[model samples]
Target chain A: MPKKEVLLEINHLKAYFPVKRKSMKEEKKVVKAVDDISLEIYRGETLGIVGESGSGKSTFGRTILKLVEPTEGEILYKGQQIQHLKGSNLQKYRNQMQMIFQDPFASLNPRMRIGAIIEEPMALQLTLTKEQRKKRVKELLQKVGLAEDAMHKYLHEFSGGQRQRIGIARALAINPEFIIADEPVSALDVSVQSQVLNLLMDLQDEFQLTYLFISHDLSVVKHISDRVAVLYLGRIVEIGTKKELYANPLHPYTQALLSAIPVVNFDEPKQAIPLQGELPSPMNPPVGCVFHTRCPFVMGKCHQVRPTMQEMNEHQRVACFLYDK
Target chain B: MEPINTQQVLLEVSNLKIQFQLKNGKQAKVVDDVSFSIHKGETVALVGESGSGKSITSLAIMRLLPIPPGEITAGTIHFNGNNLLDYKNKEMSHIRGNDISMVFQEPMTSLDPVFTIGNQLMESIRRHRKVSKKEAREKAIHLLQEVGIANADKMIAEYPHQLSGGMRQRVMIAIAMANNPQLLIADEPTTALDVTVQAQILNLMMKMKKEHRSAILFITHDMSVVAETADRVMVMYAGQIVEEAPVRELFLNPQHPYTTALLKTMPSLDTDVERLPSIPGIVPPAYALPDGCRFAPRCQFAMEQCQTLQPEVLTVNEAHKVRCHLFSGKEERAYAEEGSLT
Candidate 1:
């Protein structure tokens, strides 16, 4: 195997939102959407973040792309802290990190032609002429499995799968090193979903692009990710290689989440490990272990002292009292 | 558990055909000659991807299709041994919530925000049954508690906005089972929910359905959900029932090319594969569907006859039927390759 390069590193990243209350006199409340998370993204691998709604997985991805300003901590791009850069320095960093949103219908401007949508990013990032950009757009359309004529049509003229293809083409327009795909395939049908997933995988291989693939669907994330991370209530519960995590998940929350995914094969039916209660609000997240409220194997200590990420092995890291040494 | 009377069919839809009027004075068939029956206490899942007309078929059963634009051109929906098509609007309204109820995909939108959960549940009970406000309220709380809401007593007075997605869906299920209806139509009830929450809701639905012995028409595109909850599964494509079989049999030995493609395309949680065997093309639009098999364009085993000749439902076994030319005359065991057939 060849030596891998560290493309991006996040340390103690926190993204908080000010909560609005009815009474204006009340002290402001903050929703810690992403709280004290650290991870490393290699140059050419897909890091999947799986969680339920309001799990802060999306916030983490947005923070990585610098879409949401991090309340604290450092985001190192190629060993340079780029979290709070401004002016042309920020623009240069932004070009290297692009985002593919969840909804294709809303992500692509309906009024603009498909060609213009794909070229907009290139125009902003690259110093190419208009003619060169148009040529590159045609090449991108073909690479994502669309026809050259698709450039002239509006976004609504295409189906869900085709629209997603256009989104991929746009993401590749700037030739970024890392792409944050936030629930990219969740809005698509199952058949179309496979197509888009395959397309993303192929494009990753061809472009040697690193990805922060965020999705709530575990099956999809497992299918595409080299490493998987489980997020619960704005905290990373477990992170490991796909094989290590899927075969021997350590965190109680990870175990429950993996078992809860309904298996398709009937010969091997899964008895779901049911989790109690819904995900607690991020505005007032549970103290100590964020998942203590619903953790099946929770202890009294979990309600009082938060467990930090403990390295279990070379490839697996888990945040749980059960793994405490 | 009470022994279910399998002989008694709660709802029977035969040769159901539906079409929608296009803006250009043209009519497009959305569902054609679709037929199935649900026995008492049986859960029959109508499984298909989008544009398969599964939702439209469910809407037709509820008689909720917008007229002029949408119309049921043929077939009868027999509920409790009576043809529902014969019921007038007034009679249908009486039967809608009392004998039959529906739970939609998005519970937040399905539930009214202004009304309290208690108000909505009690209103349905009082409208269908002769009961006082006090009696209705008691029944409402009982239903909520049965659905596993911890603070049902205090939660009933709160509006739908106060509850989470999972709780809202549970309340929807509570309302659907309030009358102990003979039939329940769950149209992708868990599609909008998270995986963990989906499992919880599905477990609750199965438990309530067993206690009531109500037949369920579970409409969803997720094959995994169908495997977990359904007794029988019907695969629909291009507005037609391409295959129908017992749940285990369908997963173990899928017959139709479309069904095989679907089962193969699903990313299995138990196993990991480098790449899934995706079906080649999209489902053709309604107006431009093939003259014969709708899936022929995407079918890997498609032959010349498949493009122009319509295939009839061929019985492979007592509990399995498929609509594909390859299996039309071959022995069922000949094609069972244990996932290596493709």
Candidate 2:
């Protein structure tokens, strides 16, 4: 293994939301959105967090940046655990970690001009004069491939790809070493998608940034990620390098997820081993392995016992009964 | 199931041109001189960007293009050997949804929130075909089952809001195929859908094409979907078919500059590039199009002659055809020589 410098280390991260009371005497039920997830993000490397909807991939990314308060976990940024910090300390930590939201339309304020929107992050984190901030915003916009003069235009005036570029520029306002891009290119067209992705790759090289890029697109993950983690029903089912995960995927869930992607070539035929059913309601997930209900190679032990993450090889980790000795 | 026959043309559309009347009363062509023939049960994809006139072309064929602002100025849209563009409102109504139906991009907003799937499905059958409530209800269930709904019986009672996005889309497909239409027009059917659901839907549509023998004109921007499903592909840009070829041939060897750029811009899943390339500028608006070739501004091999003279469609091979000056060897060699020097 090449010297993996840990940028962010998260251990036993859990986020639970309170469910409504059924009766007056009933205790509030806790929705285990993110049960227990342990992860390591390396310096200047893209760590892909991938999952279906309601898989807690988005929650895990947000909780790491302290956007949402965690019920339980120890998040070590650099070397220090930043779980209970508040006020100035929390603000300082936030400057180091920035997040790009999924929806460009909802993430940006519709009323604000493009320039002001990008400048808002810098104004909140840094103390700079108006002239300095404006100059910085212009530079940031140009870096993201937006025109300098288009600062006066509102978010609605810009296209989906252009808006996402603005969103990226805002995330880069404080020169944050780490970024959490939550499905940044999912909304754009395929032609425009490559542009945004290329820009992201370019920005990463220029800044030496670490990315916790969260998306459902495995192809995108495979293209950019140094390490890819597959999440299923609030659990990281598999974690390995991009080559290991795609070439020889261990977990049945990962296998199904990868096979589901439509092969672009018409010449090559793929025998799809589809997951039998839809992901069961997150409110009432199955016992033991959450994926066992849909896993093609389900074992008798899988239904009764939950599989823990076990290292199968030097860099590959899989949570599946089939992988167990 | 309708048997596949190569000679049988289910929908033969020729020289179809639609224009929108501007505030000055002058008409601006949106779909200019488009022609294609779709065989029974064959999937033909009309592909392009936001203003490529792909969607408008589909709407024109359906005779659903909004009037006043929009009009099918010239062209013959022949479906089942009938001139559909010349049909009166009542005459066109019989063809619309009875012989041909459409599925839109946004499935969620397209459906009525209050109506149950049962009512919507039955309404289409009852409205078009002279069928009683009981027979229509049974057909609706069968239609639901045909589109891959697990419990078609129970799902019919549930409202649109009650079902998942994929299920609702299946319901929409059920309605489109209610009267056993020979043709189906789908505009970005899988755009709002996730890849898994999208795969399921496309596979479902492909399966249905085999079973029903329905000719489908699918409008989409997804190159992957086009590569996977389309039998014949049309590359539209700025209200013209810049290139048209067999699906495999188009991707493998794209002749047009725009088509080549589009293929290059897409990040390959199987192959990785050091830096993903992009065409420098945004697609120019239709209102302010270049006088000669619409794609000249974005074309990498644009010459001085490209700005002055418009190129006619040139035959590359038996199956492939492209509208480009490069193929004709008409490119200004002196200008090209100068370009190489710079």
Q: Clash pairs of candidate 2?
A: none
Worst 10 residues of 2 chain B by lDDT: B333-342
lDDT of 2 by residue, A1-325 (tens): 5898998999999988888887979876777788899989999999998898788999888899888899998999998989899999998898887899878899999999999999998788668989999999999999999999879999987778889999999999999999999999887766678788889999999999999999988887887788999998888999998888888988888888877777677766877876665677677778889887887787789888989999999879998888768
User: What residue pairs are clashing in model 1?
Assistant: none
Give residue A325's error in model 1 in angstroms.
1.4
User: Which tens-of-lDDT digit does each residue in B230-304 have in candidate 2?
Assistant: 988989988989999999999887778788778776765677667776766666666666888888987777877
Error of 1 at B285 (Å): 1.3
**Model 1: per-residue lDDT, tens digit, B176-283?**
999999899999999999988998999999999988878899999999889989999999999999999999999887888788888878877777788877776788
Task: Give the Cα error of residue A132 in candidate 2, in Å.
Answer: 1.5
Give the 10-residue window scoring lowest on summed lDDT in candidate 1 chain B.
B331-340
Regions of model 1 farther than 4 Å from truth: A265-269, B330-341
Q: CA lDDT of A18 in candidate 2?
A: 83
Candidate 2, superposed: residue stretches over 4 Å from native: A21-30, B20-29, B330-342
